[model samples]
Target: MDSFVNFFKKIPNKFASSAKELGKVQGIAIIAMLLALRVVLGMFANIGLAFNPYVKIGFTFLPMALVAYYFGPVCSMITACLGDVLSYVFAPAGASFTPGITAGYIIEACLLGIILYKEKISLPRTIICEVLVTLIGSLAINTYFIYMFYGLTYLQLLGLRAATLIPWAIIEGILVAVVVKALNRVPAISKNLPTT
Candidate 1:
């Protein structure tokens, strides 16, 4: 614990200052690839879904958070919004733009990146963070949109969606932790660690 604390204290002086910062180049590249991957994933995810459009795999946020974690919360937020813009620009007709979805993605990705930017990257902590962000950040924002426009109180919508999303959320949470942790382990990515 003492060593850990000392290491953290040294971060700002050691890496944060001179550790060759990860600029917009990395951030933009990662986000662009992430957005493209999302489109491909979305295309595949649409198949076999008979009921809800929103219930498919939610892995898109993971990479944004990864970007944020490696870059910063502000970058994550910007990337998420940019992704929404790209998604809108590229999406075919009938797939209109949605500010609500963009807001939710930005919120979730920013929170995840901001929350774990300094904390030790344990799997448990990562999973908990993923769940917290998805539930409080993404779900809350989207549910409010549903409540305001679609006809449902926030709490009622929360209850309904929470219950419905429990399984999907759990699975995605695990997936996020696994995928991010694995990515973190990669030397190329880990070398570009967050600003302590």
Candidate 2:
């Protein structure tokens, strides 16, 4: 129980530390480059399901995961929100701005940070983290946002969106594990990455 309480206590401290990164030039530059990568991936690298306009499979999660792993939750949240806004601005996609969707992205990034920051990058951990993020951030949060926007029943939205969750989680988990492991092989990036 004390351990659980301590874990909760650490969260705010982590967030504070991450928030402070915004003031650093190196942090800002890294985040800016990652944010740009996120926007490009979101705009050009996603595939919309033919049956559901709301369902998109994208690589934006890569940058979000990287930011979370590097800087922790607050910075990840900020990057996610900015990336979402910028993606929308650059490519309107015939939809008005939706804060709810951006909120989902924030939640996604926060979850990733909480799960991955300062932790060993392993396949099982990455898989579990991706699953949880998809379940909470994408399925639960974003589904509701889509329901609100498109006037679809919440259950319908969930049904449609859930179809991609497992596959996405597995594929992304493998990709994240492979990518981080590969990056760890590079001396420059490995120095920046948290040691396992």
Give the candidate number with the greatest TM-score.
Answer: 2
The numbered model that scores best in lDDT is: 2
Candidate 1 per-residue lDDT over residues 69-153, each given as its tens digit:
5665665666677766765666542335668877887787667665666555666676677778768765688677656655667
Model 2 local distance difference test score? 0.86
Candidate 1, number of clashes: 0
lDDT of 2 by residue, 1-196 (tens): 9966876777877787778777878778878899999999989999988876778888999999988987889889999999999999999765689899899989999999887877778999899999999999999998887787777799987987888776888899889989878887999977764453
Candidate 2's displacement at residue 79, Å, is 0.2
Model 1, stretches more than 4 Å misplaced? 1-27, 42-56, 92-96, 148-153, 188-196
TM per candidate? 0.70, 0.90
Residue pairs with backbone atoms closer than 3 Å in model 2 (clashes): none
The models' CA-based lDDT, in order, is 0.62, 0.86
